[model samples]
Target chain A: MKIVVCMKPVPSSEARINIASDGRSIDPTDVEMVANPYDEYAVEEALRIKEARGEGEVIVLTVAAEAARSEIRKCLAMGVDRGVIVQDPALLGGDGIGTARVLAAVIRELEPELVLCGKLSIDVESDVVGIALAEYLDWPHVSLATKIEWPDGKMAKVQREIEGGAEIVEVSLPAVVTAEKGLNEPRYASLKGIMAAKRKPIEAVTPSVDAGQVGAAGAGVEIVAMNPPPARGGGKKFEGEIEEVVPQVVELLKSEAKIL
Target chain B: MAGRVLVFAEQRDGQCRKSVFEALGLAAQLGDEVHALLVGDAVASQAAELGAHGAQTVHTVEDERLARYWNEGYAAALAAAIDTVQPDLVLLIATVMGKDLLARVAARRNLAALTDCITLTENEGTFEAVKSMYGGKIFATIRAKRTPAIASLRPSAYPVPERQEAQPTVQALAVDLPAEQRARVVEVRKKEEGQIDVQEAEVIVSGGRGIKDPKNFEMIAGLAQVFGAAVGASRAAVDAGWIDHSHQVGQTGKTVSPKLYVAVGISGAIQHLAGMRTSQCILAINKDPDAPIFSIADYGIVGDLFKVVPALVAEVKKVQA
Candidate 1:
């Protein structure tokens, strides 16, 4: 079996995100960047599936700038058999649909049996990439997968998280599954894995797909601006008996906040 | 004239989710004639309630596939409706299903899509949307360049207005679904029985890594019980295996803004802050006085959660009694 994992580098969750001077975008400089947290689940799930099968190639693909080499290397160290970096300036600033187009082209070239991605990237929080990728490739897609069991070479039983509950789904192979965190415990790169990763081949190529066909450009979705959240105003705490606090809180909600 | 605003009044089991009414209230702000598209089997019965919330017309798409949330099928239906109505703005509740389907519709139609918007306004013929970024710590305002702007509004962000009799007209549309596009949903396995969904809760009591152990969650649950709140966990608590990921509240977990949020033993990392910063009241209980959580907390108790939570829970019980 062949599996492909799509990964991206995003700012570490702990980093303080500041709006740029233009007040429409995040300040990228001086912030620590790491593999998107959810992508770690994807990489780990792919590695786990290969280990369980005892015979498979786990290929990790990333479409990022040259600066993301170190981040890609981390996936290699973790047990990915190989890597592919689709590097291009034109690919920059495209949204999920654009990213999916590039990924579909890569998947077609590789012809993998399975594809995996993080449910959503931290920066964009647009959980569209996997769904759009599946649509583009004409494959069955499941988002927020918590558990997966392969019953046969052609089909897999999967569980996906939904509002208030989860749904158990059966999807045929050659499908796409987006990994939520906790789907699997991602293993850190071991010493042996790190040394072996150095020998792993990483192919860097330009996306064969047209830039116009990818992202919001093709899908007709465009981001007009990104700004900081409004500052929370000072609030008074009512410390006393519950009788005192509950009504006070409710009063605050009705009067000042107008939320009730 | 600005096109009539469109709201996708998402329903399950024949009842409209509270977020639908909230979206309707928001739609009223955009225009006087609010058109709602409801897709489900046997959902037309709820049209009058939708009208009460300001829907002038209810476009009902009834199909068996719509009953169980067929993403591709529903996207096709919504796209077909968008083509026919040509509304200037489209609104959907940023629920799990809404988030999943809107992207596909937006992608297929090549329309600008925004998700999890907390606030919205129209200025000079352009609709601007504000979304929480970095979890909920930062807010980013976005504007779409295309007509029929598509956006998913966050739950609990907007208030559901009182019902008024508008007597909305209902229209039924037929959507042809292809067999290949329908992904089979074998079964819906709900999370552990009795566990409340944090996203739908009005009051949330969350525990963090500071709780020390899984058993400590009982105290948080006790407080939750007193306030009729849902129990939540920080990523650290979830990572530590003290609770399920469903209870996680943070940037990587669930983004929630309950009416009241109580954080116990949490250090207030920016990621965690992003999830609950929008809550109306934030109360933090931690031993460390310098915990970042206090920076945003409306009420801070610089004490051990083990000691403070039980007392808080007891006090809440006393208050409710």
Candidate 2:
């Protein structure tokens, strides 16, 4: 069995974002880029499947303007067999559908039996590329899966988290599954694995220019402006006995929030 | 004449979600003919309701597999339906299912899609939307420069419109599940039976690391029960193994914007704020006066949660009674 996991680097949640003067994109020079937290779960789940089967290979794949070396290395350090980066300058600021076209092209070449990705990247948070990739490749896809069981190499059963509960689903091999946070505990790279990852080979592939092949030329969505959400205004604190304070809170709820 | 707009009606237990109604309302404004696609077992029962919300025609796809949201089946059904409707815009509620399904259909046809649109408008048949990023810290204005675009309307961003008295033409849409969908659902385990989903709750009482243990979450639940509110937790609490991931609210968890949100023992991390900042009114109860949660809270009570929670619960009970 061959398993492939898709991952991306996004702005760290803790870092303050600075939108560039272009009014369309963010300035990246001062910001810290971390592996999208959700994709870490994808990498972790792939490693677990490989360990359990004890034979198949686990590979990580990414598409970005420049090769995301650190993010790819992070997955390799966590025990992926190899890494693939489809680097192209045109991929920058591309829409999710175009990106999916390129990724689906690369994955088709690999012809993996199963593919996985994070439910959504922390930056775009579109939840588009994963599902779009599955559709572009013409495969069964499941999103936000918390638990997966491969009853047989040809079949898979997964428990996906919906609005309130779990939906148990079964799909055939050559499927795409998106990882949510509860899927598994992503392990840190051990010293030995980190040392080994330094020598791991990173393969770079250029995207095909067949119009619909890479589809970078057909970015359907364009960013028009960038701004911050209006401030909510600093709040006020209450003081007094519990009885008095409760009434005040209720009055504020009725007057301020108007929910009471 | 304006182009046709297809609104995908999302339902659970045969009832439509508020966001679905909002999508229908928005679709009515954007197009001359507003069509609703109701896909699931017994979903046709909602045809009249969809019509009341501005749908001129309702396309019903009934299947047991469609009961729970599976992408392969829904995408195929939608792609088949689109061939007949040929909509200028396909609008869906930005729920977990809606976001996933629309993207798949869009990709199938090599079309453009913008998901979770907080602000959406169509000009000369072009679709432009605004979506917040970086945990709601920044906003991006995205435009889809094509006809027949796909977009998901964010929940709580738009309001449901008044209902009409007339009924719509409800037509049956047959689904074709492809061979690739060998995945099957064995069971659907509802963890919090009879409890309202936190996403749709008007009031939310959330706990954080300060809750200490899973057993201690009982207090938080007790307060939530008093007001018939849903329970939420910060990512830290979920990471500490105190609650299920479904209860988490933050960048890694579900985003919620209830009428009133009570944050207990939570120091507002930006990631956590990203999920709940849009709540109409926030109340923070924490031991640390400097907690970031207090910054956004409309009302704050600086004290120990163990003591404050029980006291607040009792007071709420008295007021409601």
**Per-residue lDDT of candidate 1, residues B205-227 (tens digit):** 99999989899898888888777
lDDT of 2 by residue, B1-321 (tens): 388988888888889988888998888788899998988887788899889889999998898777866677788788877887999889988887888888888888766788888888988778999987777777888888776788998887889899879789989976666654455666778875766678878899999988888888888889888878899999899989888989988788877878889998889998899788888889998888888888889899877778778888777666667
- The residue ranges of model 2 lying beyond 4 angstroms of the native Cα positions read A212-216, A239-243, B63-67, B174-180
In candidate 1, what are the lDDT values of residues A74-152, reduced to their tens digit?
9999999999988776765677777887888888989998999998889877667888888788787777888988878
The lDDT values for all models are 0.81, 0.83
**Over the stretch A1-260, how does candidate 2's per-residue lDDT look in tens digits?**
79999989998988777789897778888788888988899899999998988889988988864648888998899998899997766654578888888888889989998899999898867678888888878788888889988877678788898877888888877899999889999999999999999999889887564564344457877778888766786588875666567667877776676766
Docking category for candidate 2? medium
Off by over 4 Å in 1: A213-226, A233-260, B192-194
Each candidate's chain A: what TM-score? 0.90, 0.95
